[model samples]
Target: MTWLLVIAGAAVGAPLRYLTDRFVQARHDTAFPWGTLTANVLGSLLLGVLTGAATLGDHRLHLLIGTGLCGALTTYSTFSYETLQLVGVGARLYALINLALTLTSGLGAFSVGHAVAQAMST
Candidate 1:
């Protein structure tokens, strides 16, 4: 049952990640992988929230959201690929910016999510 739930969650998460990536790419004219960053940040935030909520003993929820949704949504590979592309294009500064933003914002989202979840519980 747990495995099944995780598989289902992955299915949903992957498509969601792809859609979000496409949407961000389309919206922005830049070649940077804004979509991947967006997904990662959001995924971090969600993980925080889900981790907090897991205190309530909801394995299925964890499997679905953490394993399935966040696992798929947060893409480290894409981030790395985009950074590599930036470097290849001779946009070292741009690549640095992407790296900094991804790290900082991803951390921020996780913090926010943790705080939000804790607050919700209290």
Candidate 2:
């Protein structure tokens, strides 16, 4: 039952990830993977919220949303690929930009989500 729920969530998350990738790629072109970065940041936020809530309530909820959905929605492979591409193209500035943006945004999003969840519980 739990596995089924996770699988379903993954199915949804994967497609959503694909759509986000396509949309961002279309808008920004294939030069950089802005789409993947956005998805990962958003996913990190959602996972933070889910995990915080689960700590206060139910674990299964976190498993389904964070571990399954967000996990599938954010592709580390894409991030790695983009970073390597940046280095390969000798775009040191762009690679650094990507690294800083991804880390900062992801951390910010996670903090916001955790704060929100904590507030909601109180």
Candidate 3:
């Protein structure tokens, strides 16, 4: 059952990530890969909320959202390759900004998500 739920979540997550990436990228002519950044940060935020909610004893929710949804929604490979491409193209500043913003924003979003979940639980 858990595996089935995870598969279902992944089924939704993968394409959602792709579509989200394309949509965001299409909206911006910049080379900053905003799509990937958005997807990753959103994934992180969701996982954090899921984690906070998991304290209520729901393994299936964790597997479905945390492991499945977030796992499929975020892509370390794309992020790494984009960073490499930025470096190769001499857009070192953009690459650094991407890195710093991705890290910082992901962390901040996760923290906010967790806090929201905690508040809701309370």
lDDT of 3 by residue, 1-105 (tens): 779988988998999899999999999999999999999999989987887776885888888888888999988899999999999999999999999989998
lDDT of each: 0.91, 0.83, 0.90
lDDT value for model 1: 0.91
Can you tell me which runs of candidate 1 are displaced by over 4 Å? none
Q: How many angstroms is residue 95 displaced in model 1 relative to the true structure, after the best TM-score fit?
A: 0.7
How many steric clashes between backbone atoms does each model show?
0, 0, 0
The lDDT-based order of candidates, best leading, equals 1, 3, 2
Q: Which residue pairs does candidate 2 place in steric collision?
A: none
- For candidate 1, write residues 1-122 as lDDT tens digits: 79898899999999999999999989998878889999999899999888866677578888888999899999999999999999999989989999999999999998899888888888
What local lDDT does model 3 show for residue 116?
A: 89
Q: Which ten residues in a row have the lowest lDDT in candidate 3?
A: 48-57
Which scores greater on lDDT, model 2 or model 3? 3
What ranking emerges by TM-score with the best candidate at the front?
Answer: 1, 3, 2
Q: How would you encode candidate 2's per-residue C-alpha lDDT over 65-98 as one tens digit per residue? A: 8768998998888888898899899987888888
